[model samples]
Target: MSTSVVENLGPTVQNVPVTEATAAPSALDTGLTLGAVVQTEGTTFTLWAPAAERVELALIADDGSQRNMDLAHTGEFWTGFVPGVGHGQRYGYRVHGPFDPAHGLRFNPSKLLLDPYARAVDGTLDYSSPLIYDSSDGDSAGHVPVGVVVAGSEPPPPISRPVHWGETVIYELHTKGFTKLHPDVPEHQRGTYAGLAHPSVIGYLVDLGITSAELLPIHHFLTEPSIAARGLPNYWGYNSLGYFAPHAPYSSSGSRGEQVAEFKAMVAAFHAAGIEVILDVVYNHTAEGGFDGPTLSFRGIDNRAYYRLGHGGTMYDVTGTGNSVNTAHPQVRRLMMDSLRYWVEEMGVDGFRFDLAVTLIRNERHEVDTVDHPFLAEVAADPVLGRVKLISEPWDIGPFGYQVGNFGTPWSEWNGKFRDSVRDVWRNSSDGVKDLAYRLSGSSDLYGDDGRYPYASINFVTAHDGFTLRDLVSYDHKHNEANHEDNRDGTDDNRSWNCGVEGETDDPAVIALRKRQMANLMSTLILSTGVPMLTAGDECGRTQHGNNNAYCQDSEISWFDWSLPDAWSDHLGLTRRLLALRAAHPVLRQWHYFSGEPVVEGGRKDLSWIAPHGGEMTEADWYDGNLRTLGMFLAGDALRATDAVGNALTDSSFLLALNATAETRQVVVPDASWAPAYEVVLDTSNSMVTEVEAGATVPLAPRCLVLLRAL
Candidate 1:
């Protein structure tokens, strides 16, 4: 889509007027004027300069032609209506003011400044001593009145498509890691935004049934000083440099505005395919690390205002990324809120998953407060952002960091317990059946009340942070040797089992067992009563060569191999079938916690656990570590949807039997009042099941799961 086409697709839902600023007395009216040239109504511009002694809009043409349009100063805001200057126009503000840093004024008339609301920036930020704050000379350095002209242009391409929340299933992925080795993406477009938007990439996502792709941090970021010296780039892109600009490295076209266009095109294509786009935002910290770091946007703008400091002007490392942003500050909070609103309104993004969100909620006293935090409360209440799918990493590396269930209602979290518990139950040890039951039932122990539903807890067996599903079942330990960290990095407590073999093997038995284990993990994840997140490439059995911390290895160690053998194809097919089953069954995706009560009058409970002997589970049976044979009976009539008067809506029933023991056990089908005969729908012991006679016991294979539907 062209920029003009995007501009014509106007009036998004997030374009609400700035109500808070309009309701209050103008701060610019009482203070020195600051200039702003806002483009609205296509080809028309409005300029604002509060304390400018004189303001002029100098349009710099491509051939070095210049035209000075004198701006009109209204009540604090300079207004103008320029026709010829539309998209792709390069301009800057020339304002005359005192240049002082100690008293917080660095407005140089000679130094042309880019518009703060510029949708797209045009030039690269060349690192030089000129961009630093110097206090060497009296007036030229300390409060320098030097001409520092940095190249910039009008805001980038406008966002055309904005999908709603209810229709979003966010798939968080790293841009570079996603397409670094994508076979179909061209060599030039391989790690760029264009690559992610390619038909091949989008086709995979469409098949996966995910509605939104939540990309990891894409803001222009800097490699850490320590990491830079070792010649390592920040692969995660968590440390942001420019909020408005797209990361230059991910742009295949290399044009200043092309990145914006490409990113928008990606969103538009996804929207066209009925999918949303979410960004994993990092506002907790910046690339400007601690006291001794580069002075980027926020730090250069106002160090004390933007960052939390310790006693005697030291830096407080709350996010473990050095300087923690002082989101408690009013202006700092405005910066973050404005950034979020900008993405939602102008970038066509549907939602955001905040990284280190707890840091943003920290108050001025350096204490994390969910209630009093203005920024958090503002986002939760803001009409433009309130309805957006707001997810939180929900923790930081600070004191009392793990805030899993702390985020208030209308917010979902990455359930770490779900990841660990599921992994432990299937891959670590089979002793935690009771713990696995809690996770499978939507983790009510963590988020049961406050109107939060099961979807609020995003359950997953594996994520980008750790081992892939294939690796989890194949490697007993993390292989971080490729990271050059001497295998010191990555978590040691992976709770993974090698299944009697380490890494890849030619042993057919081991390979077969691993594939079955992968199926089991995927089955549990999709069948669970919460939103399941499947890591990219997990369906095709992607492996990171046993490297859990492959964040630095941008080569094959992280790239997903789409090419698979027939066995792998079968596993992928099974994964797809499991996901389809989950989508088809209302009993599997219950919004509320399983009440364990019957919906039908005088019928069986909605769910009933059974022992190998076909009797209802007793306390002793549930607690027995050796007793791994378990069965669950789900009543279709009992799980029916109700009207205002609580009546049945749909009829479906099934039974799931799981045998985690080393020895095969007989799973007796109970002749209950609700279900008299059960038909085999899925049997992991064999490739397919034809039929099983009613009341005829079936021998469940060791470490196998079987599903049956009532006939």
Candidate 2:
């Protein structure tokens, strides 16, 4: 017996080794490829089912003809090779084993199982069809998608001009939602991979000054039966089904294996444009829900091995999903590592943002341990994966899951605290000034002395899971009735402040206030000392009708509305200006924590907190719960950085003042004469620029921000 040309290299899918003793009876033994591995002569299909007494390959022909072929089992793997089968061949596996759901051994031969390592799958899943769960043989063949035998192809060369972490700006978006309604994209190409890679889309991102595009889950996912039956769709794509394959629906071409090439082409295009592609991956769990859920690939192949089985076979889910992937298991870890490498090496993606990543770092007993987790250490040491960016959601629903700042060096995390604290200050909460100061200054309290830089905090005031910047000031409560969960599914603690009304209103005063607040949040995010991730459509005020959890609203509720509102243009312009300011000022994105100590002798301190009374902030001023007025002085001459060409960089010293109260506050500049004159760079209240004399008292408007550059 000879091993297949393409053998399972990374830790074997099963405990079986790639030796002649563990090879199938056939001369061409495809050892543990675990899917339809297409060859020049034929296609060899393999599956891992250790508990199966027998396994059969059901090949569905192009003419809808069904051919059932027996497979030879050697150790834990079953292999079968068909001479005539070639690329585009559709097939699935049927395993015969014990079917006791209570004991977590569910091997129903009647339920045609999908290949867990399928690179491409044809057709869509009809969850309601009986063939999906029970044996309907030929009757079920049309209802369920079959794995397509795709020929291996090399990916384009890696991006040469990768964005550095210090200067990277992330734009988080949904693949379909981002361009689904863009006028520039063709109707046929809208919401497709081709559309996203279009020159028009690329140009918009470049103009927005975002170095990377962090897409929400684009992995092949299944729409939950409950949500689909209710006429709603899972717009977020969090429910992953096939980890190795890109979502076929996102491609303009048919699902007959063209999606793989289309996805790769999209990555290549982004790299060509010098923009990095970051995928928001969902590996914490699969679409297969709780114990009674559908028998998907993982559940049918190796239920006890792939998923964490709690007391008496019940799933110990930490991701809020019913079944959590048993990452502690060697085979499961291999599956994840292989999938990740495939995306980067074979698909050309630059990085990944793990959703509910805390679940992946848990021990075998389902205990969270960021320091000692085998997966974390493996990722840190992986030569291929270590070079690419690795971001973690940093929290799950389990105990000790909120390990935000606990991640080691080289790993950044979604700063949930930054989002909350920023919201608190603008909402005019008591003692919020201190929280705002901490977050705006790189969240030192969270990442301080942890061997991580300011970029470790991926800061955003609004994300896809919550209200958009527009809705934050428009709705006092979540109006998620459109989700069909009676508005009870989303979190009630929104921390949002409606300008004056609960929902949309015509009052000019309320609308004006809301616009100002949006500007405030955006300014704080870009000008702060950390990496900023702007949610798609947030710059143009795309709203979800107050539905924070628009995960299931696949219609206009989730799509990016290209038809911009009147105020949305202003919003977009403001965002562009603020990002431009961030790009110009290295002091705003300092790599090290500011110690209030001067870098150059006789120079100003790197940073200093200022009170409204023209003096440095005192202990008593910081403790004032009602203090809503604050100012910060940034020393540009201190800690100067160099450009890529090794040329020394210079920036202007800046003084930023904030007045979150209902009345104007006079902010006095320090009398130390850091600069002879200060020019107002931006004012959120008026969206204008002016000039002020040094040591002058600038009257900042109520609930507004003023940035002044020393001249």
TM-score of each: 0.81, 0.93
Candidate 2 segments whose C-alpha is farther than 4 A from its true place = 1-18, 21-34, 134-140, 565-567, 645-648, 687-689
True lDDT of residue 585, candidate 2: 76
List candidate 1 segments past 4 Å from native: 1-118, 121-170, 428-431, 565-567, 625-627, 640-648, 687-696
Q: Write the per-residue lDDT of candidate 2 for residues 404-510, one digit (tens) a residue.
A: 89887779999999998888889887484887888888888888867888888999999999999999989889999888888789998888999878988899999
**Candidate 1 at residue 539, lDDT?**
82
- Tens-digit lDDT track of model 1 for 350-443: 7788888888888888887866678767887888787577888888988877888778777888888898887777653767477777787788
lDDT of each: 0.67, 0.82
Give the number of colliding residue pairs in candidate 1.
12
